[model samples]
Target: MERLNGYKHLILGNHDRGHSLAWWLNVGFDEVSEHPIIYKNFFFLSHEPMYMNKHMPYVNVHGHIHGQKYAGVNYFNVCVEHWDYTPLTFEQIRDAVVPSEEQA
Candidate 1:
């Protein structure tokens, strides 16, 4: 909390250990919710991806399925591989999972 000088934060609720820690620590969060977050772009941060049909049009960023599993759906798995967080961007996610115009 002290480390971040000028940045806003948001917290979502789920049955995850890390998220629980973050909710307790971070103080800059503008909003907190038990439901999924929907910003200009959505990042579904969860320990795992369950049945998330409501969060469509917004990509889901989960971290339970080990290794990279790019479902045709807009879901990005950020699970740990050998104790590391594999960072990914929305563009990368769109390119990998979203099909080209011809395919779409």
Candidate 2:
């Protein structure tokens, strides 16, 4: 993997478990997690899609499904295939999901 300029956090996926946590850190990930983590009390970041209902307050941003999308308004697939092979900023994601008036 190419070295990225900002803080790199990795949420381990099924394939990522083949290596040790230290190995991932050495490869340039600043932080590593074995499970889903909540960000800003609304975005649930994870490697795989977590179950969500329409009434749920949090939006799940995940990637394990690749080209396929999880069926829910609260699910955002960060898979490269969905974004023309480019990563998106948190602001872009936030704006796409939450209206500016609703954002804090």
Best by TM-score: 2
Question: Per-residue lDDT for 2-98 in model 1, tens only?
Answer: 5544443433434433565456545555445555554546555544675558446666766556666646376767555723644455566567656
lDDT, residue 57, model 2: 85
Q: Give the Cα RMSD of candidate 1.
A: 5.4
Which residue ranges in model 2 land beyond 4 Å of their true spot? none
Question: Any residue pairs clashing in model 1, and if so which?
Answer: none
The lDDT leader among the candidates is: 2
On residues 52-85, what C-alpha lDDT tens digit does candidate 2 reach at each position? 8887789999999875876677888898888898
Candidate 1 — which residues are off by over 4 angstroms? 1-23, 26-35, 41-43, 53-55, 67-72, 82-84, 100-104
Question: What is the lDDT of every predicted structure here?
Answer: 0.55, 0.88
Clashing pairs in 2: none
RMSD of model 2, in Å? 1.7
